[model samples]
Target: MEPNNEKSIGVQLTWPIKQSSRVPTPATPQAEDQKIEQGSSKKRKTSDIWNHFTKIKDGATTKAICLNCSATLSAQSNAGTNHLWRHYHRCKSEPRQSVLVPRNSQSLPELIRPPKFNQEAMQECLVEMIVAHQYPFSMVEHRSFREFISALQPKFKMIDQATLQTECMNLYKKRKAVISKQFDDHPSKIALTLEHWSSLDTSSFLKISAHYINPQWKLISRTIAFRLLPPPVDANVIVECITDVLEDWKLLNKCGSITAESSNSNDLAVNKICEMLKERQLLKSTDDYFHVRCAAGAMKEIVQEAFKTTQEAISKLRRIVHLVTATEASKASLQEVAGNCGLPSNKLPSRDILSRWDSTYSMISDALNFQLAFEYLQATQPEYLDCPTALEWLQLKTLKEALEVFHESVSSLSKTDLPSANRSYLNMKKIERHLSKPEHYENNHSINIICPMANAFQKYWARLREFSEIASVLDPRLKLQYLQFSLVKQHGVLVAGEKLTISKNRLICPTIPQLRV
Candidate 1:
């Protein structure tokens, strides 16, 4: 150690050493050139850090000292040829220096580096997006959503059609996010986030703008929240744009530019993107995200079910009907209360008392209407079923299991938890006794008998027609009635025969008397 004076020092290094010095061996022309190139890449040839900031050429007589042993060496004669020979000769007599270590670029921080996001990681993420987000792998090339991100982070070696889809999807999602966050932040503000934020391409803008044109009110905002919003929604901006497009349909007719073939591959994707954006209330009016022409062909359903225009009446009705039927056929959800902890559904007055059954009934009824409508339209017009009795039995089993779970919950609770412990205890005892009795006496199977199972097909079809016509105004996309006639042929007639087809113009009310083919 050196004295801790003004120039305090430890193990020291200097430019030149007084004692013997050794140099590297000279190389052939090819090797020499490579050395020169390597030397040039470093600021100081003997530096530990690797850097290619500015390289010194092979012919240049660059000189530097080994920072380790303080030995000076020159590129020419003294370093390798003459000096190396001296070192080789002296090495047999004297000990060699042991200060050299491997060099790395990390030693210096100013070097140009690769991006932060991993290329391989980005590629894997994109692949996952295709598999997980219901997008096709081919979309990764075409959509800007994927394309730009990919360009920023090239996941694969060769980007194909996915590039286009990536671009398209990325742009839409970004735009939607921007709009969604903007509107969600200032929910009551009329100034909406523009669907085509001047930055979007005009060709793709058509698709992006479709939702703006034919907006789903529920998705845009909860009807209550939407109503609270202030006027104009950038009234000056949207009203002006809307006026411009409505006045000249050509301005918005760019939808024609997107050919059917182009849409086929991407329709599901587009619809989903639009739906997600709208559901989150990301888009504002005058955006025309879906470009849906007003359904002026709405039926009388608009009056009875939906508040929308009469033209959409028929379509909305079909949607409501399907909604009902879905609940009925959702075999997973239908439950039973029989043999709960020690309580029997049949023996207990619970069904007759019906405390919570109304909610369930309403739910089932609504679900049944929607569900059966979807089935009826599918069946009479297309092909459809009452699930087999075995399925019904399975559903019953599930109901039984649910009851058992409930009983377990009740039994698990302490007696102090009950309002009347003695009464509850007796009730539990009675329930256990009743459930233990034979199944036939309690008439558990009689439930099916009580239910109207005779005209399942006829009733299912009739319910569909009713709901489709009535709910058409509520959801115009449910033009199941229109397509229904394609199956149930002949006007104002109802029959359960095979291959039923209603005429296109048929509009029979479900409440009306049945008509035979």
Candidate 2:
């Protein structure tokens, strides 16, 4: 070959091997019984070598101390390391001598509450609010949202890094698929373009958004309180201040002032819709048509106002949940909110959110019944459940559980508020009469038994008409003037009054359940 100087002068062409910079570590050998003994390893005690407990208290052993650590043991005393090992896992520290404290031992008192103010005293209200007999926020809390927003004065003047972080803290991080700055909100099928911003009053979705995403809102003691009356001098003074503001809103937004002063003064705008819903033709005519141009605006206003109570209730439930993960001090503040509204106050369910939990609690018996069904299915026809997709199975399971929960809950809550539970129960009874046996517990989860649940109030009203006497015994809270509940067998209802009884049925001599001596 020709003496190719270009090839000869070229650098050597060879594949370079690159090795990792990691050092290989050899495996550790297992410790032997002899090697793990004394003498050569005298510095480390035999017990310490194997760590065969710090010290032993044979209950009648010689008094001894673990020199390796500060643990102690005594022959006559139970304050020894041996006694403590049972709880050492939960002590949150190194093992030490321990003494058993009886859970309810009254003589040698452990801890008790101070009179009015204590670390735990602050939690009393919160726990109660979380587990109250009824959730108050669901009833009166929404009023606070508007009042608080109107009350708060945004702190733009002196935005500290902390305050700025807080404001930015709640900012949602949404990313577009193309990673653009703008958000694309899909339009509804019946879209109505607005001429002005005010044309879009608060809609149901907007109310939901406002609950969490208000730039003006601030967390007072971790409870989201819209900055009403500006940021007060003391951030800690928020609970009581916000409480007063909300209370005022409730008083001002009195249901009494809603209706016009006419012959039918009793009928408020909201009540009118409630009545019109029964008259499907009137409701659909007005709702479906009634000025297509102004339809969205009117519908938004109608929905927001008519179901103001429902919206408010949902918001209150939401606020109660926000403070669920707060300090004892902050929890006390939440309790004030709960107290203003009726809700459970203790043993708060550990769930995703307070509102969902409150809603869940409102349907406790439904949850329990669901659990029972789950167990029953597992024991019997697990494959019937497995055949469905995970999500489908869960949905069906949850629905079944909800039914059971509603059924049991109405039965229990019935005794306290007859009108309310009576209505709820009658709905269940309708499902029972039409789709189930006399006892609903039997074959409720049959694949074939699927029917739309009857509305409790609808069933209640029907029942009320059945038993005219029922209305007389109904509670004032249920608006008993024309209250109702469905009954068992035939097409009729049991009504509530001061004296409860069944109203309509084939039975000529009708009588409510009675206890005669």
Candidate 3:
């Protein structure tokens, strides 16, 4: 069988060899010379004219064909190669090469490398700027912006509004995919923060963010969802939306806690989510312990409540600010007076919104800063009678100092790099100490004003979750001893002893050993 296979392969190979066999044809000398010249293009021999001409047999005579212009000439041995050289020199289609050599003749300028421009990179940068700054898509089409870009780089082609929108969508999808992969790779439980925002047109959006510590110990916060909530956004609707977001991101079972503003709807939503997690056997803590209230939101409520009791003096200050900023002439007069009073003219009067106490604080702060300027205006102009009396000013000073404490605490908690839960108790303690001080109140009016404020502060501070207490204990600076001391200072020794024992029990519990500094 092997011998037969070898014979069959030999027969198949010989078939093509037999088919290619043909009788040789005689060739002319000039054609033979042309073949040799074509083969030796790298190292020329004989005349250089052969480099641009090829010998060919036309019937009984031989001729030369120009490679450049494709012209024909005589190639008989009797006629030398002179005509070929003349035609090669005069060939209009031939390419020219200019060489540069050294000697003291005029030399060409040295080539300087210009900065390289990448159109795709510039497009990416433009898309990033638009997304980061929230610029309109039509900004690229504006005549002035285009002119500015053209001046900066003339080679860049400006994209249209539709093209820019497409680029932005592509960038958003790419970044979202990257973040989704990160979430998938993250190992620890993710904490969530959610908020509901409304625009000027009354459209509401729910922005949900995921927070987690990566393997490198860096805290990362990424917005996972910004979805429109339809009308009648009740607790059920919020829960369903949050569940969809969690399931969509594949984070339903991995979520540890949720932070949101203190409200009935959010509370019910958290309860529903906890039930879902428990069904999957993922929740180890109760729902009450899992819900973390927004510290900033709680402080806002405290400040607004404090603002209500002191509206009389605030209204007088608001009227004076309104008077000074009513017109350009009045602003100029105030600026002049503020300069003469040795205060910053840039700290001019500012108006405040009724709903935002922070702005009210700003209005009061600016007014107090320019108190002397206001008094000067009151003495010079009879129309300026809105300045508060000395007692009211003193009350405003006391109120400012008290509000400053809350402001500092909120500012500290809003930072993202540090642990906020651990510091929340400490900040609350600072506020409690400030409110409890009798030296801060000078008169009956001051006492009456501070009493309501203190009540407001305590109302929110009492509702803090057990997580804050545990977190405070985890802090190296304020260990279990400090927490015990703090509890005894606030609550009596008996109550504080019970609370301290409970915290210690949780810390030493084997099932909940995940808690660490």
Candidate 4:
């Protein structure tokens, strides 16, 4: 019964269905605008184009900015996002701009694209490092080196020794092929320097290096072959090894000269090579002039022979070095003494190896530099009694001065940048002039040193290679004048003239073929 009134009221409310009878409540324009703005904002948040832009209020106006181009556009709800979308498409069509900023800048952030990691490129670099430094393959297994690499790039996987070795061999083969192609394409003949030496382990190795001027007229020296030289390293075996290398590098026909030590086996090998060149019609005339004697080896021989004369004094200096450097305390004492004597404490003595005259030169130079310190050590330290006497120190100074010339000359001739052959005569002449200085023979002590050096120089440098002589003359800077001057310094003016005449005749007759300039 109660519901019947409620129903009657609801029926009355329905009867007044204000479609036409009642004025409809007026809609608020502000509320409608707000609704529209909210709907548009929702639409913008959902649209994919809004991701490239950041929305912001510029005073009362809403704006949309492009992240890449930093462009601003209207973003009001009523402005319709269609323009914003159009601007985004157009801005993306052009390349993204890069803006440089000053050191203390507060500007648009820089957009930097980081380099992508390339595992293969990194591995190749590691393999190159191994090859370049002559690192053993097992270096990959070294804990510190591996840790260093891992710290450098955690993404780079470490290769095992076996894999590293495989990669290195592959690289070697690839580079060898490229070099072989270069040699094949080279227009000029290739001269070779052959070095055969035995290691401390008694294992002999032969290193064959090729020298030639490129098309650009630049001198290049590259080792073509380094391999084991098996037993019976005689003339035939040496020739066979060299032949194999030449053939392997496709340089057999292009072979111009072979330089080796002045030994019986090497001499015979040169003779055999000369005969072979003649047989192949590779020689321009009949002579064993294709062989160039190793000037460095000759220089070493002279120093070694000269070293015998000063062995007693050298032993004394060696003892001094041993006394000074025997222990840490001795070394400190020497340094203290050096510092007190107004000398550099770092200037310490160098040990001399019996077989290496270069080491001998270094030892003499260093010991001579520390002479005052050595005297102080002998005076203060009772245990340090091996200091060279004043006269002995003077003698060592003289010896160092004399050996310094040979040392410098040898170093100059040992350079591999250009052909050392061209410089052989000049260096030899330098040694001759230094030794035959008339002032050197004045004092008995000087005579004792100079006589042995001159004798050793004569014994080793007695016969200058014809090719070396010719090469010196070929130099534009020196030409015949330098050669004539050098020859006159050694063999007097008349003999020098005769030698020049012989050299000219030999060149005219063309005794050697494919001469490397």
Candidate 5:
């Protein structure tokens, strides 16, 4: 085999080269030149992983350090840039900085900046706070309130009282425009509730709320007007005010019934409103539209009278509650006793507001629930001098039971979201049944409570025929049968039949003998 120079050179080229002791410096200029050339040839792609590694130059050596993990790797070597690629891949495989220990505080970047105040959103929040909480417009000017808002958002500029008032009026006007449009688009008749309130300054205001059924059969209610009534409020003045509101909303002809507290002035107002409507050919007569009494007002009257009968018992319970809650020490002692007897922590007695019968009932009921606690306190504590006697507690129990019926009745009729008018007669009937039978009472004390309540209800019951009875008779669940039965039970068969005939005629319904039979 003769030596061939071409074959020898090829064999030598195939042999591996020995590694150099002096590593090649990272090709700075070459790398820059290569990068520029590559940039021209191809579009540069950016990635988040590239942000963590920073290229560092030390004398002639070049290396990469991960900003997040602080891992260092040689960038220039005889083996080439494979170490830089491996280091980046390993650093990316490691957990993200946010998942690891927080980046060194000194090196951490600010994550959040102060936000600019959104005036519209802030204005809406202020309006909601005022409306929902019944806060005065000047509340925003309160130092404490301003400080609270500042704590929440330091950059927010709060409105002054004058600006707040202007915003309130603008909001009202905007809402009125929306509601007026709703009335115009509504397909059903609107029922209204009128209330007159007098302030301490003797300024009178007439509030009117509208209720109507939507196309979806949902009952919707909204307060439409709260207008100041000039001095000398009379039927004509009230009628004018109401008409203006109704006309403003284009609801004068669409009005159904107007409910107000049973008062001479309100009755006259309703009559006058109907008369004006009739003159305008909007209604046929005053009777064409119903003038209903407030069911809650009637119930309040009944409860008020019923409360008078148990005033002595209520007063004693009130004194006991007062003493129990008189001091921190007394409350603590009472809590201790209550806990010992396994009584609920909330079973502590409550004080009653003389004007509100429901509060009176709560006082008595709470006293009854914590009867053992009261007894224990009476025996042990010398300061609790006005504790109720055994007989007094029995009276309180009786009073509570009797008052519960009225409370429940009032609650049911006060549901503005539901059709309470249709159920008025049924609720009245339930109240009557509860009071009618003396056998339901365990003692004469309870009977005494029932008598006055029954009397108060009877007074209002007779007036139900004016409107509520008509609603009851029209209800599909009760129909004419309930009216006939109720009438006969109260006013005998002959009168019941005659009254039914008159009611049917008024309702423009055909007389059916079965209703009378």
Candidate 6:
């Protein structure tokens, strides 16, 4: 009987299930299979239901929580997630109350929305307008510009002229800082070209441009200073200004040379700069390598002076070109004459610029190429008043040939990208040899023209050889041979040997082994 009571107790325990807290249980296999089948059936259509609602488990029920309002909703299998779509639409159309949280529960912080005006985009546009185009700062306050900005971005605030000026100055400072850092880090010596320019308003400005060889062996030029100069731009003022700029860039010791137009003030400025360098111990008292006159400018002055001797012949040639190209009728006549002379029909005589000697040289060269056409025109047309005479033509030919040498030298030395210093002495020597030709001296007209040019060239030649002999010696193509030959020509062989020995002792012997004779 007692065993029977135990069985009854077991039956009673089985009948009364133990009460436990409800937790979400995993779905049964069959339910999962049904869900998979339903999902597969709906896979043909893409779903965006996740954008507005998040899936969440509540005990045994699968629910979707609205992202906008935090409203909890049960998902129905028959309707799929359509109920959540409707709830989202309703919440968007009609603003819902913020979800209240329990006092002890934690909630996420609210998101902060961006302002309607995009300040950064507007500022960038402002900078581009002012800096890139060099637009005046007052242009920012222009009514049309303001309207344009408003049309582009209605809520963006427009900046004033004062504000734009400040921005420009700040931008300049930032750029200057970057350039200063580059100058400080450059590995090669910095060559500078200094010039004083007067504006139309009579305001003077000192321009300093930097030239250096980059790591890739390419020459680079940049304008480092274009500052307004105060009154009395004397040698001392020029020296002070240049020194301040060089010191500002920390380039005093790194300076290779300072080139300026040939002027007494510039010469004095060079002397002062050399003194300053010596005072700073950056250059020795005997170092004269840091000063160089502008080669192009020197050549221009020499050519201009030499051309003055042949003004009569050059004037006749210039008149001939002007007459031929005076009118369309004259041009047509010249063309017909050219065709008959077996010359190029379309080739017209070039006009020369009075200030540019190179242009004059080009005019002479071109007229010589069309000599037959000009001669034909002169023979047939008696009314051609400025026709060049035979002697004038001969003069033109000799002048063209002689000036060709000068033109080629100027062109080669004027190039900014090439190393012209090493070739300076060699070029001068070549020109000297060209002028010393017997034909140039035999003809009276040729001698009259060549003597003065030779004299002017010699003056500049001596100056160049003095400064550039060492540079020539340094060149791989023209080593000590060029220097010795130049010295032997200028001085005797005994003096040449003594000068070479001195040069070797001062320049090469200290840094390199002595060369064998």
**Highest-TM-score candidate:** 4
Counted clashes in each candidate structure: 81, 47, 0, 0, 0, 0
The models' CA-based lDDT, in order, is: 0.32, 0.30, 0.76, 0.74, 0.72, 0.72
Tell me the spans in candidate 6 whose CA falls farther than 4 Å from its real position. 1-171, 186-189, 195-206, 213-220, 227-244, 247-256, 276-282, 323-330, 375-383, 485-499, 505-517
- lDDT tens digits by residue: candidate 4, 377-467: 7887776576667777777777888888878987775564674567887787788888888888788777777787788777666566576
Candidates in order, TM-scores: namely: 0.20, 0.17, 0.71, 0.72, 0.65, 0.63
Candidate 3 lDDT by residue in tens digits, 1-517: 1112322221121111111244222223454456446753545335445656789999989999987678999998778665675675466766541222333222323453234599999999999999899998889989999999999999999999889989988998899889888988877778898888887788878999988877786778888999998888888889888999998888876787888887889888988888878888887654445677777777787777667777788888889899889999999999999899898998786999875677777788778989888889889998787788777877787778779888788767766466557888888888888889978576786786688878877777777736677778777888988988988997989999998898888766753443322
Of the candidates numbered 3 and 6, which has the greater lDDT value?
3
- Give a tens-digit lDDT track for model 5, residues 172-258: 888888988887888656789998877779899999999876777677888988999997988778988998999788888778678
**1-517: candidate 1 lDDT, tens digit per residue:** 2112345233232222323353333234334335445754543233111110112335556543433333445535334433332333233222233332224434435554333556555555655566567776566455666556657646445456646467557755555566544334432322111222122232222112221111223223111111111232333333344434423332222221111111222334334434444455543322332421111111111111111212132223333334323654422122221122222222211111112222222332233323333333345442233321334333333233223422442444333332211122232323333333344234444333212222222232332333233233223554554334433543234552232333222334331111100
Residue 351 lDDT in candidate 3? 99
For candidate 6, report its TM-score: 0.63
Q: Which window of ten consecutive residues has the lowest lDDT sum in model 3? A: 10-19
Residue 395, candidate 3: alpha-carbon lDDT: 70
* lDDT pick, better of 2 and 5: 5
What would you estimate as the lDDT of candidate 1? 0.32
When 4 and 6 are scored with TM-score, the better candidate is 4
Q: lDDT, candidate 5, residue 474?
A: 64
Off by over 4 Å in 3: 1-122, 143-158, 285-287, 336-346, 379-382, 389-391, 485-498, 509-517
User: Given candidate 1, what's the lDDT at residue 263?
Assistant: 23
**Pairing residues by index, what is the TM-score of model 3?**
0.71
Clash tally for model 5: 0
- At residue 214, give the lDDT of candidate 6: 68
Scored by Cα lDDT, where does model 3 land? 0.76
Tens-digit lDDT track of model 2 for 169-244: 3331221122111112211111111111111332111010001111332211111123332232232232233334
TM-score rank order:
4, 3, 5, 6, 1, 2
* Residue 444 displacement (Å), model 1: 16
Clashing pairs in 5: none
